[model samples]
Target chain A: MKKSSKKTGIALLLILAGVGVLILKGVSDTGVYYRTVSEVLIDSSLLEERGVRISGEVEGGTITYDQQELKLIFVVRDLEEVEKTMKVVYIGIKPDAFDADV
Target chain B: MVTLGNLSQSAAFMCSLLAMVLLLTGLMRNDLRFIEAGRRALTGVAVFASMAAFSLARLFMTDNFQVEYVASYSDRALPIFYKATSFWAGQKGSLLFWAWVLSIHVAMVAFNTRKETTRKNTPYIYLVLAAIVSFFFLLLITVSSPFEPLAYVPKDGNGLNPMLQNPGMIFHPPTLFLGYIGFTIPFAYAIASLISGKVDPDWLKKTRRWNILSWIFLTIGIILGGQWAYVELGWGGFWAWDPVENASFIPWLISTAFIHTSIIQERRNIMKVWNMSLIVLTFLTCIFGTYLVRSGILQSVHDFGATGLGGYFLVFMIVTAVGSIILIAESYGDLRTAHSLESLVSRESTFLFNNVILLAIAFSTFFGTIFPLISEVITGNKLTVGEPFFNMVNTPLFLLLLAITGLCPLISWRKASINNLKQNFMYPFGLASAGGGVMFGFGIREFYPLMAFTLSLFVSATIVLEFIGGARARKKLTGEPILLAFPKVIWKLRRRYGGYIVHFGVVLVVVGITGSTAFKLEKETTLQRGEVMNIGDYTLQYKDFNSFQDRNRTVYAATIGVVKDGKAMGDMFTERRYYINAKQPTTEVSVRMSLKEDLYLTMPMIGKNDEITIKAAVNPLLVWGWIGGTFMVVGGIMAIIPSRRRRLAV
Candidate 1:
């Protein structure tokens, strides 16, 4: 083998080792935190115990806020027409248009 | 507001149709008159498209609720400046804006090349470009017309998305579109060269500045988007590995690699095939990225609404990919590398390695992005490929890329001695070690951050060493001070020195990102009036709550007093405004910023009585990301300035 080929072989081995190590590390579930409301509704007990996130549109006339404590209470509707509302209690600052969506 | 509902749309459509028809006739008959007619039609298209866009903007600024786009994006309450910015805040308007930009760019290319000679096959190129333009213009008129009138125009319409109201929107879309559509010019040129059997280096030289212009715009656009996210998105971070964000970044990486590789071709007549392929791939990625973001193929905060154009884009991408490969294969003889690699340690080999790694990263990202769609298609399972997948695949590769960035500048063009390489790299290595030791002493023990901080230090050290070496050499030879000598060195070799500055800026950005991400602190608390919450070293006291009604919005605000080290700093008032007519709730984040960190607070929820809870984030060194981005923009501009010797480089 040529001298350059030997050097490239070494580099390739090192890169391959790195890739192997990374793959062996396995995939973490933290990357994708997406779940539809319908999916969560089917298995509420599975996720309700964990600090997981669920997203849906806020039901009209169901959102209440306390400016002093910076707490928001709302009901997120599963379907646009149906009144299947899930109560959401968040202790954080709300986006400006959150109330306007209602 | 100027009215352009039907007439201008028809004019745009007709002009594009006429251009395409003329191009086809010219290609078929090999007639110069038909080609000239095609060129004139392109100019007419430019005029009509610009008028349509300008009229749309005027309607937005004047608060013309009669226009559906304006009614949807702007309200009577918005200031004229923000109203103007709402031009690209939504789907229909942004697409129209994109079409307008493309028309202008295409027209400019046609007008500038009027005096040039084509190698008997330029009509084919014009035909391709004209056909592409017609597709967008027709799409604009048919599906997503910005000029369509609202059937039942209420007293007011829904306002622009509050997230897009920042100043970043004004510059981000234009700069990105400039970069995105600008590549089409060079891609068309490549196709023309391939068809005309002219495989000369002149095409590359001719499009050199155009390449740089697009690259620069892409850089600025990415930076602007990051800045907007950091300041506006209350997320306390810049890059979130969102699908839409990655789409823009992938093209940038490939284009940057191409930029570096093209230098060898221009200098030594090597890597001809690689340059051509890079241009084509970069253009395709740009188009694909636009489709990804605008087509709603992925669920992202940054993505727009779904449209029928998704399938159209998929078909178009397939056709372009297959057609380009066929063209390359047919011209296989001309596509070979003009020079062979002599040594693995040479600059050429390093560039090749960089290209391989960049392309790997691109492919990996592309796979991750489209995997969900593939999964849905194959298994009928809608799974999300999120931040975890990207961080797993891309982070390590980018870290290696950072190391390569340090090494590429030191390696000789053909070959270099080990001693010489060691001598060049020693100082930077020492600086990086010292930086890592400092970080370790400061209580940072995380593995990835530690490596990133060390690599960033190494990259910065290399850039500094490069500048000092060049300036010292010039100073010794020309009797100039280091400060005065630096600009002269830059002027002498704009690409070399300006690129080093850009690298330095990149180092700063990576450092800022690492610091903010790894060292960020956040907490959630519920506090009553006159009650205080402690997070990190700052004390936040809930002071007052106010509710009021304005002409357009109902405002609910929280007045929180921020105290650092038990000393009163300032009061930050966060608000949640409800636009009454549009029935949209928008958030306004309040922040206290310094050079070292930002105290970002957002009012996500307000209670019925007086209690409240705020999401406050302490993000460190985030401002430097914006500063670094600005530096990069400056460096790109400096690099493009025409020197005394190369007047046509611009």
Candidate 2:
């Protein structure tokens, strides 16, 4: 490569490297792993990971909302296996689409 | 009526297909007659497409329950405007709408390319447009036909989704579609340049207004969607980093990168290959974005159900990408840059860096959007990436982009000496430092927001300095009153100055985003009648809740009094509406917006005895986003206006 072209290449590589590092660091730092209730039921250690979003069917009649202090507790069962259930404790009000019958 | 619509659509499809064939054959045989016929066929396609579109809209207006699409998205009770917009609400209707808009664009291109200068390239350009229009019609007529008839006609159709009953539904979809379809014109021009081996800055200059026009539409559409979400969706926050949001945003990012780099190509006759790739990628990503929204491959709050259209969309995207890549490769020799970056301090380098940053952000967002699929394929687990991942990744990069927006104009072209850099950046840098110091004194010392605000002010400062410098120069040269020369200076150099205005507007938007996200406060409580709740120094007293019938729905509105610092700040109302045909109620959030903050309230739920739960929030500096959006649209208009060539005496 010509000297000038090589210099340009180095500059390009440096910027790309800097951006690559930023993206990788963010992925490791804030990327949330997701799990289904069945998987979590099999290995509870999944929840021990830094951040995990669990997918499940909210068991009917297991939702309780304390409107006074805005605490919510609910039981969600696996989509496929009803026996695999996880109780969740949340400290926020329900969003607009939080249907009680879900 | 359904038969007419179906026949018109079929005819439109045949016209586009015939246009493609004739245009290709005309090129091979060198027959102007055949190409002229092809161009006329394009006009025919537009006519038939419009007829079909009108037919479907007529079905909705007449409440024709015999049509499946109309039956699904409209009801007898919906208003006329909403019933009209229902033409593009569902998958079938949306595909038809895409074809309709695209056919109009094709017709515009065919009729407008009559000049001797443009005649040589019209055949290839028309062929590309015809091919694209044919693809949409292929999807529409075969898989997702709006003209499909129902087996049984019900008494009354299902109403439009209550969530879609807002004014946004009327405006957002069509505007976004215009943007999504507008990129095809530029893409077609690029393809024409490749096939004809006439790759130069000519196509770039010809399509500048088209690019800016489409970009403005996309910007407005996004801003309107955010407004809709904040007020109607009751999310309290404007953006959620959802898959559908990422779909539209990725193309915007790529197109933004193209808009910046194409200038370098135009002025310096370089980066031709990069500009080509960016435009082609932009158009393909528009298709990809539409696919993500329509295919339902990923779970999103949008809830566009999993259709069988994913494979077809995947095929289209791959086919276009491969075809464009082959053509670009064929013209690789012509696409070479005449010059390379002369120095790191050059404007060209800044454009390159800006492109890199933009593409990086787009790639990461695209990766995050399809992470579930990637994870499932790799690990047998559908791991969903969410808001935190996006925020962590994009925030710093966006801050970097903000910094570049300030730095790009400050640097001279090709190369700049240290003295020039010092002269240009000194004021912006000092202003940013002062901005940081002021915010720190106001106890606004949080890391991310502080950095964002400082960078935003820096960018704003550069733009302001450019304006002042230009106006002063004009004043000294003309020996006119400074006031008269200011506007004249802007008019003379409208394109550059207007771009600076847009940069200033972006700074406002960033400031708004940072302040609102960082300093947001929320409180929720169950309020009995005549009870009061306090959040963020504002006391909201619930006056009463009442229900009334409004047109097609029952509206439940809560009148609440707001008091701030011992002063009555008027009243705000939260509404919960139960559309008769909808399965659930929808919330109408009430917000009292000011320059400083937004006082937002939502009635999420009502229990027995009319005890209501109110979600209250104070989002600081939220109005700046909308105002900045206005400036962007206005500045974009100014930039796109054909600059008057009034010769400058200076």
Candidate 3:
């Protein structure tokens, strides 16, 4: 009984170790920095050569799209700090929920 | 004057509260009369909740703009079917629907267990279920009542969200809610067992069918939600790893673990503590998922706008968590297992590993879903973990799970000898390797796809081998034809074979997801009239543009002609709709589905220069996912059906 329990413990330890390694690798590989417009504006260098998603409200009537080139240029202002604004250039179809308020 | 809807809603809430009080008193005082009264009051709760739900449906059907819920989600121009389904399109109505379903389930449990033999655990079950039902009732009566009236009735109501007008929305929320509410039964039983100090396998046995039913509903609900996103959301793919999607998926992972671990408890009289904690965790995740979606703590397309009910949910979650831990800690001595693992390579060990992997996936998904909040609170930097994180983390884990699924049934219980493993695995292993080799020859060279295809093939071969070997043994023993013996074997071992069939279905689904994700081809182009764009053996030509009007929306449709390999296929028309009352524009994608692949088309925009921008994708093996989902549901149903063997054993 003791031998079998030891075996089980070793197996579990190995599995847990594998899981730990995978999780560490996964977190570093695909974690996206989420920033607000004001946060990004405060330190723009934080996003250098890294993928990030920023949450902000679109400035009304400041959105333009070039259908031929598939380019969308929009100005988004911080929800908490309305004075801070950023211009985003995206090249894809807009999401269905895209709006000035969102 | 109070409306019938208002009266019925209020009555349901009060009845649930009274029933909860009676049940709690009965459990505390060990009084059968109060327990009986509480059980009877549960019936009243069900009846009144149904009345409230029907009344809301009636309001929607009659286009009663006086009621806020009906007014917000329905308009005169909405179809009758959509109007009926709009019952769950908003927060208040969905909560009412959830409570109604929970009350009905509780009432059914009460009626089914009225026998004297099952009376011991009845009071605790009643207390747990009643407490849960009353929480929903509290929410209904206090913050988000569906029967709230508009101060002044408008002539017309704002229409339903245009994105929700599809057929998928009609079934998705209720199916998922059925799953979410269905877990309350097993959860109540688990807690009751702990509280009543009956930590035997009886509660597990009693709630087995309920557990399976909830699992099946959750599986179908998740698939249906993905299908809705794929077709209705105009995204080229399904399963974006969104927060709302993870909310549904997290409970599914925990429940899956619960189901498998409970099997160990039943078969070996082991892992009783593990089983109890898993059920508790499953129930907690379900409620936590609801809270996450409702509280808007995480931004998701599917969240109900932030409401006051978040505090109530948080308190309830904390109380339940603390209460469960205390009860379980006290009952730990009674919950000890008589049997332990005899070998590291045994069926029990396989199941344990499977549980670990499933829970690991759930943890990572839950963490990723809430990472932004965690980062914001801790480091003051919000960090979003996107699809890449989930796909990267989970794909290898799922592959491991599939390998275990292939290996578990072949391994003997308690201990498996090398000879036993060799005898079962040699042929399936060889066949899978050969299949992989053939695919490699066909130039399928990417690492993950190749691994996915190989693992899927391996699992499928294992299932087929199990069936064939069982049928052959049955034929030899019973002196019957192999084809006839197959059905007889399945009939005799329904639960075992039914699980094998579900695994087979999972194999198919994995294959479909792998093929669609890895081999999919997409092309986006702006084309003038009569101009052609070719992609993946199909040529699409911009034929014409047309416009039409319906009562609710103006639809601008673009007709595109399709020709594949010198043969002309039918014209596909995609629409850009402008809903009048909702003041929203929604894209209606056009898809031509076949056994091989789906040719999907969507028009993002129509330019002023008469150029149409079209996005076309060829998604391979997509239909197999739905087909496999059907197989899974059928297998689950077959497993739940009481076989003659079980009945005779009982």
Candidate 4:
């Protein structure tokens, strides 16, 4: 083999090996899909406790807050081909401009 | 006031653009007359922009409600100080402010450096600055004009946002702007050098201290922003991976890398390409950061409005990016390192690694900050990439960087002997390992903190060893006490040793972050008129509440007795206030800060009949972060100051 090729051959091999190790170390979360509130409401039990952020436009006039418990309940609408709405319960006090149309 | 403001700012904008065209045409045609004309036109631009700023400030001070920007951001009720800060409180005025700064910096650069450099080089530098000023001035004229008037002038105007009515806000934007504007000087100089083919050490030496000044201001700006967030937002965390925060941070990172690696280029005639790339990247990132803040591609705490300037910023970015790419490609031959690597185990290699890691961190942060935009383009989904993602990715990277910092100082330049390496690092490594062991033994399960603390100990030990070694060497030669020898050694090598002290400050900051984030204790309490809550040997007794209305705002205050070790330490008051004209609520946090920890109390909200709810936390070593930040700023100043002995002797 040529000098540079011989020197780089081991380095390339070590890099590939390291990649293989990292591949094994990382779990495949690719199949675990992310769904919006309306999409998940169709099969809520399937995503009961899995990690996801159900994002949609916060529906106007559907936000209610309990100052005592600091719980906020709001309806989020998915404005896809078919308009669908889902209820979201948040525990913390809402930020300013939270009630505005998203 | 409004009409005059419009006239002056528009005049400035047109003048700057006219000057930029003149400079560009002059450089292209090699006409001295056009260059002189360009300089005079730019002077007009500077004068007009300053006059515009002065007009706006005058209107704000006098509470001139006829002006729309003044009406939107300032009021008769606001104090003189807050009224002054109204200059940057809105989009139109902030753009005007930005234009003002750019013009002044450009004017300063033109005056100072025009005579020193060649005529050809001087024109190019002037053109670069004028081009930048033209873009911003045009932005001011077209998209977000501060001089636009309201249809109907009301009796009262909306006041400043209560959250922004802090001491930090007054200084933060200017410092950050100084940093952002300061980068343009070196960038313009570099482009000027490339065009003139006077790409030598002369320009580099001329711009080095400017680089340091920009980096230092940017550093302090970021820390002040964090302090603002911690105090104003009451988020219980200092940095939240916010887009605006990331925008400032990226340039700071690149500037830091530039400052360090430029030393290599200066002394050893190496890393020339790297240093040049860093300067370009720093300036480009400054523009990119301005776009991120002003474009509204991402939502942030710092957004004024998304406005009509997104397309302008995007087009400017593309043009600048393409231009810089072409320039860098053409200048590749001039930037190749003049020397070869002598060894892998050397200061050179360490700097290479440091640059790589710093750039990697910068890339990761940039990716995270703009990930939402990219993801939306690719997948048609807007996903929030929050603190968790950044913390996860950056924690290990920072730990590795800390390891590099710990080891880099010990290694010699060009080449290092294995024996010398071991002799330098063995004790520090052993001490850090033992420290790690003790922390692990004490049930520290978090991998990140344990690693951070371990690496911090290693870095601290290395700094200590360097100081001791230098002091001892000085004492041996001069036959003086250690204290006397220390100052003598520092005087001789202020830049190098001062940098090491700054790195020591960074170590302390990292340690403080690790301690505060991992070991803080928090609790939420709802109390009646008279009640007490005990947490971690401190008792917080809820006392009476008070309500007061001022000209600026109405304050709903929470009185509490802070008792530690069965004795009353002091009484603290936290408030949730309503600024009347703005109609916004702001939280005022009360913090009892010390060397060890901070007793932080935030009044999240209040109810009718004086029922107060507070979120209180005992955050460990939170104060040290501020202390370390102060040290970083102080060390930077020390590096800039000429040595007292040298000055005296001279």
Candidate 5:
């Protein structure tokens, strides 16, 4: 019984190590920093050369899509500070919930 | 006169309480009369619950705005089908629907176990099931009652959510509920065994079919939900690692692990404690999944409005967890394995590895789903774990699982010799390598996709080899033709072969996912009339735009002409619809599906200058996922059906 459990324990430990390595690699490679528009505006350098997802409200009537270039340019207003706005340019299909005030 | 709906609700609530009391008394005093009375009360609960569900359906169909649930979820403009399905659209009605389904299972259990021999565990099963039903009844009758009448009737009612107006909604929720509620039966049986001190294989024999049924439903439910998200949400991707989706998936992962491990328990009378705890966890996850959807503690696209039921569900979860732990701890001495591992590389160890990987996946999913809450509570910052996290972490683990799926069948039970291993794996390994070479020659360059395809080929080869070897053996034994012997051998070993087919189906699904994710091409372009966008060998020309108003919504559709290899094929229309009553807009995607690939197009927005912004994707091998799901369900059913040999033995 002792020998068998020791074998099982070693197997489990090896598996756990493998999982740990995968998780570390996964988190480092693909993890995105999530921030609000105000946070990004406060420190724009925080997102330099890194992928970040910023949540904000789409300013009404300020959306334009250049069909020829497939470029979408819109103004996103900060929810907390409604007077501050940022011009965002995206080159993809709009999400279904993109129209909502985030 | 009291309305039949109200009366039925009250009666269902009362009967569930009475059944709980009687069953508890019967379990405590060892009395048969009280147990029988409890069984009758369970039947009463089922009847009243069904009546209550039907009454709600009738109210929705007849546009009875006097009821708050009907007023909130249905209107005269709603179709009759959605009106009927609206029986589970909201919290109140969904709770009642849950109770109704639970009562049906209880009544079936009561009726089927009427024999004296089966009565040993029936009272405890009754107690567990009744306790669950009583909780739902308590929630329904006090907090969220579908039968509650509105104080004032409005001229018209609010319609169903525009996103839920699709045909998928009609079947998705009920099938998912069927799966979610189905876990309760096996759980009740597990608890019954623990309480009765009869931790034998008999309980497993009685509950095996229920476990399979629940797993199948969950598999179907998750697939249907993915399909719905793919088509309705207008995102090119199907799975987004959403919280609500994870909530459903966690339970599925646990239950899947339980199902496999229980086989060991049934065969070797081992893993008894593990099986019981896994079932308990699965049941808890089911309730937790429901709680996550209804409580709105986590923000998700699929969540309903938040309610006060979070506290109730949390309390119930804690109590059940504590109680189950104590019970299992008390029964630890009786639940030891009759046999232990003989070798590390045997089928038993393989199963253990599989269970570990499955539980690890479940743990990661649970962690990722709650990371935002955890981060906020600790660091005061919300952290979101997106698809990349899930895909990155789970891909290698899934690949390992797929590899094991091919290897487990070839390995011997107690021990396997190196020669036996080589004899089984040599051919499949060679074929897989050759197949990988061919795929690489054909321009499959990505590491993950190549690995997924190669591993899938290996698994498929293993399945084919097994089938061929089995058939040849049967032919030699019976003097039958190989083709005839193949099916005969499969029928003779239905459970084993059916599992192989299910594994093959998983291979197909993995192939589909890897192909679609790695090789898919997406283009977002704006085109004027008579202008064309070229992608691969296909060209999409903007032809015309049209707008029309129906009773419910106004649709703006863009017609795009499809041209393949310089030849005009046809036109596909994609639309953006604005629902008038719901004051919401939804994208209606257009998909041209084929065996090789799907051409998916959606018009997310139109420019002010009359130019259309279109998103197009060519997703390869996507159809195989649905086909694989179908095969999995069919194989599950095949496994469920008892064989002639077993029948004769019985």
Candidate 6:
């Protein structure tokens, strides 16, 4: 019984370890750095080829949308440093909440 | 004059606090009088909480612009049902609603006239439940009261969010609250059993129906939320892996694990420690989920944004987490089981494995939900993990869970002999391979999806085979007809059969998700007059776009003449409504739903050249998700009904 218990413990450990590895790999594969537009502007290429989620205020009058092509081009200004900006070209239906003036 | 809402809210708070003290005193001093007083105090708490809730509802119904919450979420122009629905429209009102629900559940427990068990441990139940109730009321009476009066009355109010004006919104939050708050009952019972040192299966057996009931409510809540997102939110897909969705889903997953492991405890009298932690964790995660949704820390389109009460919730979460941990630690020695697993290949071990997978998935989702915060703390940079991370980690784990779901019931109780394994394995294996072969023949090339479909088939076959096998055995024994024997067998083991039905429902949902996600076809284009959009064997010709005023809003809508299978299907209308009292417009998507596929249409924009841009998707087998949810609810309800043996024994 004791030996069987040990095996059960080891089996459980192995499963946890396997799942731990999967979580690590998944995080590494899909983790995107959430950054401000200022940070992205300061060092876009310095970062690795991973995705970056930039949080900023949209610059008014710099937004353009192609209804047919579903292309959106807008300049996102930094919340902290308003002068620092990044032009974002996104391809999707514009969300209902997204607006130029925050 | 003080409002009745405020007065009763305070009275409820006082009664709950008094109940907790009296119950604790009774527990310490062995005084039935104090315990009985504590129970009565809890009944008072329930009464006052209900009165508080009703008062708030009355305030909304009467369009009482003097109350801040009622004024904020209701208006004169809103309909009567929505005015009542405004009772839980915001944080403050929902807190009262939640408190009222918890109070009712507590009162039911206290009012139960079970003599022996009642005398022994119900004081702890009263203490624990009243403690939670008092905490909610403390927040209500002090920080975020729904009855907080405005300095001056207004003639009219700022209306409810146009997005929340849907019928789905009316039912979704309250149903979810019922589900979330329902966990508190079993949680309190578990704590009572622990503190009273009666860590028998009595608590488990008693709370079994409560667990199943709460699970059904939660299942319905989640399904309604998904349906709301699909139809109302104009997001063609149901689940988006948003933090708000994940928050609710995480608890559901944990509670599901808890519910399953509890069956083990009820039978084998083991996994008691695990069950205690799971129920405690379930309660804590419910609180955390509430915090996630109401705290406005996470970004969701649901828009129950940032509030001052979030800090209090965080403190409450920490307190409960620490307190439950301490209680579990205190009872650890009592909770240890005599029976250890004799073999890893037993039904017992499948539940353990199932738990491992479930917790892994839960942990992964929780981690993904809070990853940005963790990243910001560790690396000084916020890192976001989206659907890809969740899908990558969870898909394989879910498939493993699906496989275990198929194999768990068929395995022997303790350990399976090779012959028993062979008997169970042969048919499911052959059927699954045949199903996989058919799918491959039908050009299912993707590895994960093919595997998913095959495993879905395998799981389904096992569930069906269990029924057939049981019915056949019963028929052979009694010489009864197959149809009569089939239902009788199922009725005899209703709990297991109900579980099997739920599993079958889950299999259907998996097939639906796999089909919809893997084989979904979508089209986006600008269509002028008579321009046809070809998407997934259906063509939609652009008819006309019109702008008009409805009763309360300006409706900009487009009509599309749909054609499917060379037959002229009726025109589909997708509209955007601009409400008078709201800055934003709501999207109403058009869907032609079927068992096989759904043809969905949404128009987000129209061009100046009289052109309309339509987004359309052929979502395959998506309806089964809702169908499966209904089956799960029915099976869950079926499982909870008292069996004849138990009824006769009682």
Q: Can you write out model 1's per-residue Cα lDDT over B1-650, one digit (the tens) per residue?
A: 33564567668778988988987787678777888888888888889988888888888877788888888888877766778888888878887788788888888878877865244656656766777787777778887788888776668757766666678878988898888888888888887788777878777877777888898899999988887876677666678878887788888888888888888887778888888899999989998988887788787777776977787777778888888888877887976764566678988777877777787788767777776677568666444566666787777887888888888888888887899898988998988998899999998898888998899888888787888888899999999988999888878987788787887778778777877888899977777789888888899999999999976678889999999997999799988777655445666778787789888887666665677767888988877777777777777777777766645745
lDDT of 4: 0.80
At residue B120, candidate 1 shows an lDDT of 61
Tens digit per residue, CA lDDT, model 3, B1-650: 22776677678778877887887777778787888888888889899888888888888989989888888999999988999989999888899899999999998998888664236777888878888888898788878888889999989889888999999987899999999989999999999989989888999999999999999999889999989988988877889999989989999999988988899898889999898889999999999888987887887889897977888999999999999999999999999876788888999999999999999899888988888888789888666778888998899889999999998888989999999999999988998899999999999999888988898888988899899989999999999999899999998888888888888888888988988999999999999989999999999999999889987899999999999998999899999999987555888989998879999999988888578889999999988887888888888888898865435434
Ranking by DockQ: 6, 3, 2, 5, 1, 4
True contacts kept of each: 0.38, 0.46, 0.71, 0.03, 0.44, 0.79
Better of 1 and 4 by lDDT: 4
Question: If you score just chain A, what TM-score does every candidate get?
Answer: 0.65, 0.90, 0.90, 0.61, 0.85, 0.91
Q: What CA RMSD would candidate 4 show?
A: 3.6
Model 2 Cα lDDT, one tens digit per residue, B202-240: 999999988988888888888888888998999799899
| lDDT over C-alpha atoms for residue B480 of model 1 | 90
Going through the candidates in order, their DockQ values are 0.32, 0.54, 0.69, 0.21, 0.49, 0.76
Candidate 6 residue lDDT tens string, B1-650? 23788899999999988888887887788888888888889999999989988898888888989888888998998888888888888888888899999999888887773354244667777788888999999999898898988999988888888778889988889888899999999998899888888888888888898888898888889989999889988878889889988888888999999989998988888898999999999999999988887788888766479987789899999988898899889989999999877788899999999998999999999999898889888988788899999999999999999999999977998888999999989999899999999999999989989998999889888888899999999999999999999999998888989998899888888888888899999878878877898998898998888899775678988889999989998999999888888887778899999999999999876678667778899999888888888888888888988875434444
Per-residue lDDT tens digits of candidate 5, residues B495-559? 87888888888988997888789889998887777788987679999999999997778999999
Q: Show model 6 residue runs off by greater than 4 Å.
A: A46-48, B113-118, B644-650
Worst 10 residues of 3 chain B by lDDT: B641-650
C-alpha root-mean-square deviation, each candidate: 3.8, 2.6, 2.1, 3.6, 2.5, 2.0
- Residue A12 error, candidate 3, Å: 1.9
Output the lDDT of residue B644, model 2.
64
Instruction: Say which prediction, candidate 3 or candidate 5, comes out ahead on lDDT.
Output: 3
